[model samples]
Target: MNEELAELAASGATALVSAMGTDLWQEAKGLMIRVLGRARGSRHNELTVALDRASTAARGAVDARAVDYWTEALSRLLDRDPDLAQDVMALASLRIPERPGNVVQLISATDSAEAFAVQYGSQHFASGPKSRERGERP
Candidate 1:
């Protein structure tokens, strides 16, 4: 399963790189593909940490203009890839702070319909901590 997911991530990365024509994106995608492979095979916390590092690396590779471009591209990509959309939405949910018990309330109060939809949709597709620990393939 881990191998499969790594392949999927790699394929996504490759597609992204081909579409974007940026070395940074290519490097980041390669690292992420490897990280996902390792995580799948071992289900280690260290692997998860590495994946996070890869994500950070990928983020760092983006300039302001690139960010805008990527955002637009991703929006269009999501329209074509429901799975990617779900993964992205789930990641956004994870980014939300769950502190002070008010976090839930705060999330509930958000006025943006898009935000709410993304959050709700993410739950359906986001990989759980336990599954991650077990290296269960998405």
Candidate 2:
């Protein structure tokens, strides 16, 4: 696959997996089904079941193999119909629900420090003690 389609597949795969248990899961899955349903009627049921399995795997943990599977699937889907490739970006752009609270994301820096940023919910992110092991900096 080309770079654009490849990146879209990777991101959409991640987004589809991450949206598994969230309220937007159905929304995400619907978009995918709609796209695929238009082309392959026979594959509709099979894809739906596969998507559910991917969701289950994602709910436990972001399974790399599952992600790879979906990535390839989505990549081919888009390659066959480049016009529809744009929608996959919207899939990746789905926002995760946030609990109501004061989210104080603090980033402390010493004097003369260069530009810095604070982020959360990064793909493959780790929390607590394991964050360091995952190469995340505090």
Candidate 3:
């Protein structure tokens, strides 16, 4: 499989798993069903139920392996149904919950000096533990 397609699969799976039990659950579930249905053809209903089960598992807490499972599923689906892959990509792009431009979170920590920094897409983030700061009692 192409690396890009693999990335899409991984991203879609993560989004699907994270959306479980959130306000976006229904939308995310529906999008997965639709995309996987296109790939599964006559097996659409079966895939739908499986996706639901996975979502239910994710509702309690999402583990990294869950993302891998769904990612592999999507990758195989795309491999077998190359034509449907475009649709999957498009749906994933639009409805997988958080696209590139979405602001998923904004975290801010203030101190006299910065210890760590993360910068992405015009956003800057920094953090430092109080325990590591100077002149602080343990």
Task: Give each model's clash number.
Answer: 0, 0, 0
* Candidate 1 lDDT, 81-103, residue by residue in tens: 43564354322222222223322
lDDT of 3 by residue, 1-138 (tens): 888788888877877777777777777787787787567555567667778686656364566887888788888887777666666665466443343454466566565544454545454537535465565433
Question: Which residue pairs come into collision in candidate 3?
Answer: none
The best candidate by lDDT is 2
| lDDT of predicted model 3 | 0.69
Q: Rate the local accuracy (lDDT) of all candidates.
A: 0.39, 0.71, 0.69
TM-score of 2: 0.60
Model 3 compared with the native: what TM-score? 0.58
lDDT sort, best first = 2, 3, 1
Model 1 segments beyond 4 Å from truth?
1-62, 94-138
TM-score per prediction, in order, is 0.25, 0.60, 0.58
| Residue 33's lDDT in candidate 3 | 74
Report the candidate with higher TM-score, 2 versus 3: 2
